[model samples]
Target: MVFQARCEYGMRMTSAPDPFHIQEELKYLRLHITNFLSYQSAVLDLADLVALVGPNATGKSNAVAAIKLLREIPIHGLPIAIARRGGFDQLRHRSSGRPYNPALRLDFQFGDNPVSFYELKLRGMEGKRYEVKQERGVLHFKGDKYAFTNNAGTLGFTEMEGGHRSRVSGDRKIPVPAGQSAVSFPATFGLFIVARVLQLMQTVEINPALVGELQEPSSTREFEPDGSNTASVFEELTSETRAELVDELSAIVPGIQRIELRRLADKVTLAFVQELSEGKRREFLAKQMSDGTLRAFSILLSMLQESRPALLVIEEPEIAIHLGALRTLVDIMRQQSETTQVLITTHSADIIDTIDIDALRVVWSEDGASRIAPVAEHTREPVRQGLITPGQLLRSDSLDPASA
Candidate 1:
């Protein structure tokens, strides 16, 4: 039996009705980090395809982790998410001797609409407990700005409704609970939208070790972060979609005839069918496939997913990938960026060379704090003279701020 794909917002389809067509909306505008992890203060301007390249331990992964932490807050609450990362002490920057407040300020704009901003600040209190220092949100629409909610100091909650300002909780200051966010209040509709957008943000740290493992069949439509449920997801795709994926894979890796998902009474697994030199056919289980083949297949499945996230953050995608296939992988990612925003971290020159200079950001450390700058700012002469590519400058350490 063949299944039909369901089209939704931010999803790419071969053909669909008018109702399924929607313009690409910008979900994230900017991300500001202050005293969070290795960053003292830095702002990253988001784009369709963002690539972060730097030496190891220079806080490339930390930037991705910050987004993951923020994404978890609206779903799991604030305190639980902080505790999962070794508590507040570990999250705040330790370079300064004095106590610090770690904050994340995110700006969001949908389509051509006015921009909206949300800021969350946290500081360690007595008994090693963390509390919200200041929580505020604003929505700018139709030449007017609306402040959703502000919680700070002795002030309880100042909310704006229909362009009117009113204070809630009267004279007594209502403290936000340790595990909650002020913007998470259900009464504020604008603030709730911010929370919902954050909830939709997804991060994936692909692990090649888990990609080839067999597992129980699942009805999940989206690919998991670790790629463990790839077989199940492929089994659920439409016939047309599966054929398209097989064709793409065959082009990337020659001699591949087709990919099949085998189902038993208790388990489901993936089998790669290939054609030999004599036209002989052979099959290999997922675990029996090469690492590069398995990784490539998993990445291809993820890019072709019909129900992809609004923002997809992938860490070190170049790992376990063949050098010859890097160009194909880059092209696939660039094509998918039109529908879903893609952010990736890499140390591979081949991958970097394939990306535009405007899409690349250089991450480095200086004065015990991690910093990021656009590649255009660092390699102006080399880029103008066509002396070296961004990847070459990065490999030669010319993009490092400390070196400048």
Candidate 2:
């Protein structure tokens, strides 16, 4: 009866909130990787807005892939996440004389409390597959503590009233499937902290190519990572937010007057209304829009959503974007970072120039492995002193991590 009341008013409810609104109290601090892609071992310190800058093959994309992997684990479970990346064999680094297993650790903080962490280690098995070698996590939030550990598929969980692990009735031993993570298992005991951690791990990876595809109608209002459901998502925004989005898009594209959602049969798509002249108007379907227009529109829509993800990762968003619009794009990202962490991988000098030196992290190759760190003090000093832009330093190869 309650659900029917909401349905009559066009409200949608689910087992969990759609388009999870990341709590502002939670913030990611660091990402540690081992034997993943070009990284033999690396730690990236995260800021609200991180601009991952480097030459090609420096492992910028690898870092982004790692975060995406973490995001998938909670939703798709461990085995599928591994399979989606072509199995563990392809993901493990091929460095000579080093361990073949790949591991990842993410550190996060809830407000000013002690840091919380989740770690996962995988071991290669026969048939070019992998199994969970070990997994553990400790989370302290709102006066409740939850901790879980899984060693070789043996799972243990504890819930307590304080930060220290207290042996409560929830403490129990079980065997998780070799291919699963206890934290990702829906029926795990003491799942409050694990669920909160995974909720904050929610991430969206925007692909302009996917965002440009034609969309079909759906009842869901949640924005997807690849933005395939953009038209429907945009259609659900409140009128005030839609107005703001249209105004922002017009500023970026110079002629866009409004955005209209069109539906035909089961198909749904966006149409851009442009005022060609004082009395002349033109309409273009999303298919007819320029790549730059589509890309910018997708980004703005994500930023304007009522509920935002914990992390927004965009790879080479500069592609197909006008140089003049780069500042506008960066500005929106900066504003969005106040509510959601933004991570971008790019080689665009304009993007580097638009962001601050503190937000810059340089990725480079050292000893045939990728290493990442904050920009060198030398390069940072010049940029901070206003002697030259970070973009100039990037073009001259002065932002190399080796010099740090």
Candidate 3:
């Protein structure tokens, strides 16, 4: 909860907007991964809305997995995050029968502030053990730059003083667990930006599997990543938000008259109302709704939350949904991206066509290594000239990345 306290202090001292407020903008600009998963090296020049289109096994999901891991670092520490994904050896990129260490770098910008960055490198030790090779963060506030670093187990801090960057206040030995990151330090030594970075990252949420399953309502109002708590979250929404949600859902699914939160004694669930002939209506419980309907509802609910995350990653959102509904989903996602950085991985041609050309990054493999880049000029030309649509190009397996 260090970041939580620091977040409140930061807003009070600077009189800045709350970081979680939907109107505030704090977003990731780029993500660079080296020797992680199947990607020997890959870079995603993130935009407000980005679509990763590629053939299966081409490493689209790997890119998402990398970001998800970073999001969990501050929450679970470095060791457990790695363990949750198997282990360091399994995550490291392998070549020629040897595993290589993996490194991750993320660039972020908040409002008009200077671009800040956090970089992490994990080293593999003998006997399959792993340690934090390096963890660093730099944040610029007002006119001063604050830098924090942990080279191996040595924790250090530096700041801009009198116009020149120097190790001010000398170095102090800080005890940081070998398996933890320096960014998760309990006392940030007034380097609020360091805590801010962790706070921002902790807000990241990824789409969960089986998004449509019925849930036992709880008091927690926030949308859970797996969407199991969706009914409770929906019940907490303001009447205006509920109306807006229904309007959008009706556009996407049609015949969706409204959605109601039904509570029976100690149990709570959702009731999807559909209009029928002569102003008649039919009601379907959460368990009775189709998978596609439930999935769409869950996704829409996540995007409509009053407190949006810094980053949202969704994989293959088009699955089990009709083409028409997919279009509406894409539109809503695009609008939501204005408030949060939205990254999606999909093989759906309809998806490629709905997104802007500049928002598309094509993932492909070369010599068994994953590579990603904007659509190649040559490959994107036909779509640009209106001779071929992105959907058509995707279907033909011709969505190639531009040459470096």
Alpha-carbon RMSD, candidate 2: 5.3
Count of clashes, each model: 0, 0, 0
User: Per-residue error at 160 for model 2, in Å?
Assistant: 1.4
Candidate 3 has its poorest 10 consecutive residues by lDDT at 1-10
Model 2 pairs in collision: none
Per-residue lDDT tens digits for candidate 2, residues 1-404, read: 00010111112113255322226677888999999988999999888899889889989988887887876776667777777877788889887755478999988877876788888999988878788899988876655665678899887766666645545634446677767876566344333344445544434556656665666776766677677888988988999999999988887898898898988667878888998889799998887888788888888887777556666777787988988898998988898898788888899999999999989888988888899888877667878889999999888877756344
The alpha-carbon deviation from the true structure for residue 298 of candidate 1, after best TM-score superposition, in angstroms, is: 2.2
Worst 10 residues of 2 by lDDT: 1-10
Residue 32 in model 2: shift from native, Å?
0.5
CA error at residue 381 for candidate 3, angstroms: 2.9
Stretches > 4 Å off in candidate 1: 1-23, 96-99, 140-146, 150-176, 183-187, 376-378, 400-404
- Higher TM-score: candidate 1 or 3? 3
Model 3, residue 316: distance off in Å is 0.6
Local distance difference test scores for all models: 0.71, 0.76, 0.74
Per residue, candidate 3 scores C-alpha lDDT tens digits across 130-229 of 8889888876554456677888987676666435655454355565667777655433532445444444432223333444445577665556766777
TM-score, candidate 3, is 0.88
